[model samples]
Target: MSKLRNGFIVLLAVFGFAFGSLSSVSTEAQPVRTAEAATTAQQITKINSTLSAKNKAAKKWIAMRESGRSYTAKNGNCYGRYQLLRSYLHYNYTKVNQEKTANKYVAGRYGSWTKAKSFWLSHHWY
Candidate 1:
């Protein structure tokens, strides 16, 4: 009876250790690509010329121009997560400029609750 109890305890301990090691290995092996990082990388690329002649910068600028205070447009339009506003449409001459400006603005408004609301009104994703 004593031997059986000791064996069962050893089995449970080994199982626990195995599972813990397996979980750690899996987590370490799995590349974690955040939705934001992936989306930004994918969306920031320029579209094909057949689709639109605009470069990545141009598209970003247009998105910013169209979006308003909440980084949303007049009609159900949301550009980037940053919620760039339409008021800044002509603010920058290039898309890269627009992105830079947006980065700065978002960083400044990081903790504001109104950030999402201002961008959510039209529910437009540009």
Candidate 2:
């Protein structure tokens, strides 16, 4: 009787531990989802403000090609709409900062967003 009771207790503990781990994983995932949602909203607003009306479509096309307009997008060391190196962001992943950085990078590298889009078209990367 004692061995049976001990075995039952051990089984109960294992089940409890499994349930607890699952609950914690779910709780942690919620915050990641929320952050992703907020990043998407920020990307939309920042992209609208950063690109000139004439260049908006081209810039949008580039961003879509790079990240599908997702601010939280990542590929290896590249991140965000422009696929900037993670080091360039300096841990500041805000939309305004990303837009500013992307614009500066585009201006320096391609002279304009349209040109950048052209480059991307030929090379499949910008």
Per residue, candidate 1 scores C-alpha lDDT tens digits across 1-126 of 999999999999999999999999988766555665566555535312222333333434434545532332334332432345545544433444445555445436532223423443345432
lDDT of 2 by residue, 1-126 (tens): 999999999999999999999999999999999999788777757656756775778888888999999888999998887789988888788777788788888889998888988899999998
Please give the distance, in angstroms, between residue 120's alpha carbon in candidate 1 and its true position after superposition. 27
What are the TM-scores, per candidate, against the unseen true structure? 0.30, 0.60
Off by over 4 Å in 2: 1-51
How many Å off is the CA of 43 in candidate 2?
Answer: 11
TM-score of 1: 0.30
